[model samples]
Target: MHPALVEEFKSVDAVIASDARTAGVDAFALSLLKVERQARRFVTYLVFQYPCFGRSDVPALRKTLSDSKKVYFEGILRGFDALYPQPLEALIGAEYAHLKARVDEAELHRNKLFHGQLTEESLSRAQLLEFVVDMRRWCELLCDAGQQELGYAGFGSSSFTKSPELTMSASFRIQMQGLADYDAFIKTVLRRPQGQQAQ
Candidate 1:
């Protein structure tokens, strides 16, 4: 995905996740679904954002993403390493498989979700937050890798550091494109929890 699209995904994911987090503990199952949906949509966006995806695959990819279908999802995840610069190959090669495994493990929850087999209490709030934080970290790592591929900016030790924090404000704004604002948005989304994770 282009750097802009990657950033766009981050903004939208935070917004959606924040909204879902507003639900009381009674709806934690739904909260899991919301995060799962965002992750699915994110991978779909990456596929469509690819310069060649529009040739005919965009719609099918969108469908797969919308439905959270794992089989075809694997296809969309492919070739990401190819888009990066040669130097980035060394960086991404080791991590790409690991990222895929993380995504797959999360997506695997969808089946239990669909069959009404997953209990609301299956995981604690803290555990759910960890899943999201992990997924967000995955997203950030990919975006940083994408940036490295294009040589758009210098590498920073703490790029997209917000992935570890689970709390999100309902009124948070999306900062598109400008480097400073984008950086701030990341900080805001990732701000450390005052006490417990999530609102």
Candidate 2:
């Protein structure tokens, strides 16, 4: 999985566990919210890790990130399609729709959970933990896909710090060649969350 995603996952996991222990059922709603928040952050991190712009576009990207206003999951998905549509498609092929649907379902649950509309029919501590597990598995699937399809090593791999090179498909490599410092950026990205070990 992407290091940033993993970092956010572990951070939220610890908080949710602590809250569940102390607040019990009261924490279920807020815990799910936190999970949703972290899920959005993870999606953002995953999207941005790919090079989707030319050399002159870094400033625009930086400004976008610098703006503190929130961009919801839908907006993030649109921006990704507008910028780096092909990489994701090539990385996951026909499964893109399934991935989007999964995210959509999560977002729906988040909305219902937030509005306090979810009760015994749809919300519970076990369900919340199950959602967390599902997300973790989703991240792992994406990581595995990227490792195989793009040659980007996943976290905990022996070669995690290595840059994607000849191992990547030629077509994909050509697509990314136009982006400046892509290799260097990827090397750094792959080696991230260095000293912060997951508990």
Candidate 3:
């Protein structure tokens, strides 16, 4: 029900519809389950990677990702927004719902962590590992979604196969690199303090 989730859901639905069309499926049934799964994967990754993210930071992160998602969705929506009209529009709507639910859930989980209701034991190292793995998976999914949309628009897979053009524009590459930096930061935090260095 959160606006962030709503935006992401819409973006993802647009992406899937775009893919299906490109794949040449005529009557694809929009799968809310799949969209929900994708949304969960994304939120889980965010929460796991940035447990320290505060309410103040949530808006910025949500805004940035939402804007990115919208740009990508619009790009795909441009050519096929009218084709198969009903399904395309439906996909967009569903994605919005999916993302909204995800953002709401994530905010709740984040609040729990912030309030000390959650503990490291409650979210183990394995969970953190899984979160990173899922993050990579979601990134791949987003990339694939873009590729699929392009494919639907008559561009071959190759068209979308290269590194995302958006990722390189205007120091976005630095932002992307920050994802890795964040992982290192987490690892550093998990380590024993230098004063208590392990023998």
- Model 1 scores worst on lDDT over the 10 consecutive residues at 162-171
Predicted model with the maximum lDDT: 2
**What digit string (tens of lDDT, one per residue) describes model 1 on residues 1-199?**
4454345445445554565553223233333443344333433332233333343554454443344322233332322222222332254467656655655665565445556677445765555555555555555554555455432221232222222222221112231323343233223332333454211
Q: What lDDT score is found at residue 81 in candidate 3?
A: 32
The TM-score obtained by model 3 is: 0.25
For 97-188, candidate 3 gives per-residue lDDT tens digits of 54444433433444465476774346543343343333333334443443343222111221112233322223221122343443332233
Alpha carbon lDDT at 112, candidate 1: 55
> Would you list the C-alpha lDDT of every candidate in the order shown?
0.40, 0.45, 0.34
Ranking by lDDT: 2, 1, 3
Candidate 1 error regions (>4 Å): 1-71, 79-98, 119-121, 151-199
Q: Compute each candidate's TM-score over C-alphas.
A: 0.41, 0.47, 0.25
User: Could you say which candidate leads in TM-score?
Assistant: 2
Point out the higher-scoring one by TM-score: 1 or 2: 2
Query: How much is 141 displaced in model 1, in angstroms?
Result: 0.8
Clashes of each: 0, 0, 10
* Prediction 1 TM-score vs. true: 0.41
The residue-level lDDT of candidate 2 at 101 comes to: 61
